[model samples]
Target: MSGGGTSPDYVFAPHERPLLPGSPATPAHPTSRRFAYFAIGVFVGLTGGFGNAMVTTNLANIQGSLGLYSDQAAWLTAAYLMTNVSMSLLLVKFRQQFGLVTFARIFLPAYVLVTAAHLVAHSYTTALIVRGASGIAASALSTLCLLYIIQAMPAPWRLKGIVLGIGIPQLATPLARLLSSDLLERGQWTVLYVFELGLALISAALVMLLRLPPSERMKAFEPLDFLTFALYAPGVALLCGVLAQGRILWWTEAPWLGYAACAAIVLIAAALLIEHNRANPLLNTRWLASRDILRFALVATSVRILLSEQSYGAIGLLTALGVGNDQLIMLGLVMVLATIAGLAASAITIDPANLGRPIFWSVALIAVGAFIDSHATNLTRPQNMYFSQALIAFAAVFFMGPTLLIGILRALVKGPNHIVSFVALFSITQSIGGLAGTAFLGTFQVMREKFHSHSIVQSLTLADPQVAGRIQSLGGAYGKVLGDPSLRQAEGAALLSQQVTREANVLAFNDIFLLVTVLSLAVLVWIGIRQLRMYITGVNPMSEVLAAMARTRGQ
Candidate 1:
């Protein structure tokens, strides 16, 4: 089917298509042979998603042992997120030029190399850098698997296969978490990477054995607009920097940090202008001009970011309440239950075309759950924590299907850059939302800690006349709570202090949760306002521009 290629007919046309659908599909081979290849693709995609969690869980251990601080350690995540998003676009272009098999061949080895690099990284810098590189390769696994499935299956089964492809990887979360626990128990996190490296090799071997249809092969390749990337990089770096240090940066202030943020904004503004003017711009300015897409992007991005930051809050609260590593591992296990629940729900009502109402309702549930979590007064009970976490996870299942993504893509299919533009904007919004949530919530936590600590100290009676006189007589014995001559008296003071500190920590965490509750509520309010406006005016921010394009084409 490729016009310019000089390759032989057997190589290009492949004399025979597989017989997966039976009869016509089995003209050359049995139905089982075709299903087997699809099964292998599913396995590869599922493992890749699991590998994402494996790498993330181990990052803490790897950084801690290597003495990496927040500044250096931030890249471990930034690199992965950036490469994953950017590489999504890159894969689109590559698939246009080379076959899916060839791209898979290239990506799998790179992922394996990254896993290997993690195993041998001697210093913090090397490990951080290598982890970032590995993300690019690992991120491609799911997208490629989708493309493979879409090409292999006949039309009627393609949607079912796509749904299966996406669903399988999500199920990998619990398994990945399980592996993470085992790896952490053995000391260093590098072992997780070593395991993943072996897995990637197996994936690569499987790819070699799979047979796919020719039309699904990539059509052509295009070079990236480096100028656009140059602008995007600084924005990404600045945003990541803020998220990593925002707790210390003091929200929107803190001189140096604010300056970095300002610079990033300026750079992005310039990129927008440059791209809008260029004939073949990196971003599709015309599509962005659409009001609906803008609104959906903002709302979706906001919800995702808030949800992501909530993860940090949940983990922090767990630690504050003295949940041990083993307990946390158990908590993570509960999340798997959520994943299973999500899968089951998706199986029952998983239409990609009609996801808007479901997504809206899911966000509402998540907001309510966040409110419940905020008001949690008792941390001693595992049931309380489990209930809150499970609720959020259940809510997430409604929000995180390919339906919304498919909606957005269909909404923008008539735009100049199509998927590439959709992806770039999607990535940018997600990154920003995540950073804002994390930084805002983190700083809120720190400030709450300070405020609550002072409040608790003031509530104590340490300055009472009786206490003062006892301290004076003891000649600073209270300071040496453990080693004092009057051990009984010192122990009493120590106990009093511990009680005060415990109250203070609880109050601080409570305040932080309240702030999160308010934020989530605010998001709901914002969405409600926008939705009301759209409903009143019959203005769909998602499809307005796409609708215009359709009208123009018809005329």
Candidate 2:
């Protein structure tokens, strides 16, 4: 745990040695203090996640209030991600140099102020800025949540705290969907922001009341660091923008997407080129380009993509069937509980000897859940999806902890400098993977819907007996309301067409579900093959890193 031989330039204080090598000191607490720390850790973690969750879940309503178009409203989310994904690159260094107390003192108030600004800002531009700032604050809060949770636990159980801290945020989307109906019903959009502001104030108060122990400080920032950040931050932001808005604007149709994408490539390449030549690089490109790290990123990104089964496919299907958040409250509750269960299961059964096993099982569960959902019809409701969605939900939380631990162990073994690279790699893979998944699935859904619609329309000839009978039956209902025979017939035909469209949408969603099932199965097979090969070779990728982590934790 001594910061002696690995990196002589940076040293750890005695109290900080138990924590990450370059992290702030976290003193072990008594039992009562540990309980309090756990409570605050949960609160702050949920708060950080809930802020973005509320906004994302209620985007349509927020758009209506702001009088912005769908594409413009999407920018709000894009803005949040723009800063959120990029800030991790520098925030680690900020804490290393300035101390955790200083990091909290500045960012917590900024988060509160941004929440307030969101309430009062009537214009889209101002709101976008506020959201961007909130994203930066959120990244900081996530770090704080991990640190506080680590402090809450006894040494051996500390890794479990990390698992819970990371997994808790995944609950926000389901929690937001469950709570948003009541918030909107009681006080409209402003009420949601008010609730978020209250949480921020409480988090700020808790942090100030019981501060993290201070750590050794040094001049962690260098001129080259800012140079790399300046180039890299906006490059990632533009890439995020492209992913967020590509579907809305229709990829090939938007000219700016091409320009933005080109600019992003140039800027990111320039940043990496600068980092490559520096004596002390901000991002350790060599480590990131390693085979194991690349594989980890690929697996993580693939899982995120497959997770769109719940986020896009099932939800899109329900929305098409006239199900709303109000009707899905029970479903959300089921998912939240299932997620908590998964987190517990993962913590209890996490095997450092074989980290890939849980991930394998999680993907298998996703495939099962998606295959189950592929059988839905017009009669399908949120209640019908409870079990399948719960399986997916369980798998979602179950996989994340071990996936993260694998990377963390690897980074720890390498040295503290590689931590920044791992963080950046993780954030980009997750954020971009989500955006890519939604865009890909959504576009596929649209294309299938069109094809299905055309096929259904072609078969509905007036000459067919069943089609004629159905039209007549529909017209009969309108006969009592309309005196004109022709008008009633026209109305009935319109109704029949509407039904055809609805059925087409249902069929398209079924195709989407089947696609997810196939993709999940493919990923599972790939991972299984890799695991089998490793087993035959008698190689465990995590052994060295886990040994290193265990040694550090023991100190």
Error of 1 at 333 (Å): 2.3
Question: How would you encode candidate 1's per-residue C-alpha lDDT over 1-555 as one tens digit per residue?
Answer: 121112345342232332111101112324675576567777687757755566555555656777777556666676666556555545555655565456666778877777777778877677667756765776678765664554455555544555555555665655665567776677666667767777778887777666444333323333436666677666766766666666754556667788877887887777678878877666767777677667667776767766653466676666667764456666677877876676567545655444455566666766666666666553444456776777666655556554445434454446424666776666566545665676766777777777877876675575687665554455454555555556756666666666556666666666766665666677777767766787799866446544665564456
| Collision count for each candidate, in order | 10, 0
Candidate 1 matches the true fold with a TM-score of 0.81
Cα error, residue 360 of model 2, in Å, equals: 0.9
Clashing pairs in 1: 19-25, 19-26, 95-218, 96-218, 96-219, 96-220, 97-220, 292-541, 292-542, 293-541
Root-mean-square deviation (CA) per prediction: 5.7, 3.5
Misplaced by over 4 Å in model 2 are: 1-18, 548-555
* TM-score for each predicted model, relative to the true structure: 0.81, 0.95
Measured by TM-score, the strongest candidate is: 2
Top candidate when judged by lDDT against the true structure: 2
Q: Write the per-residue lDDT of candidate 2 for residues 165-208, one digit (tens) a residue.
A: 88888888899999989999998798999999999999999888
Pairs that collide, model 2: none
Instruction: TM-score for candidate 2, please give it.
Output: 0.95
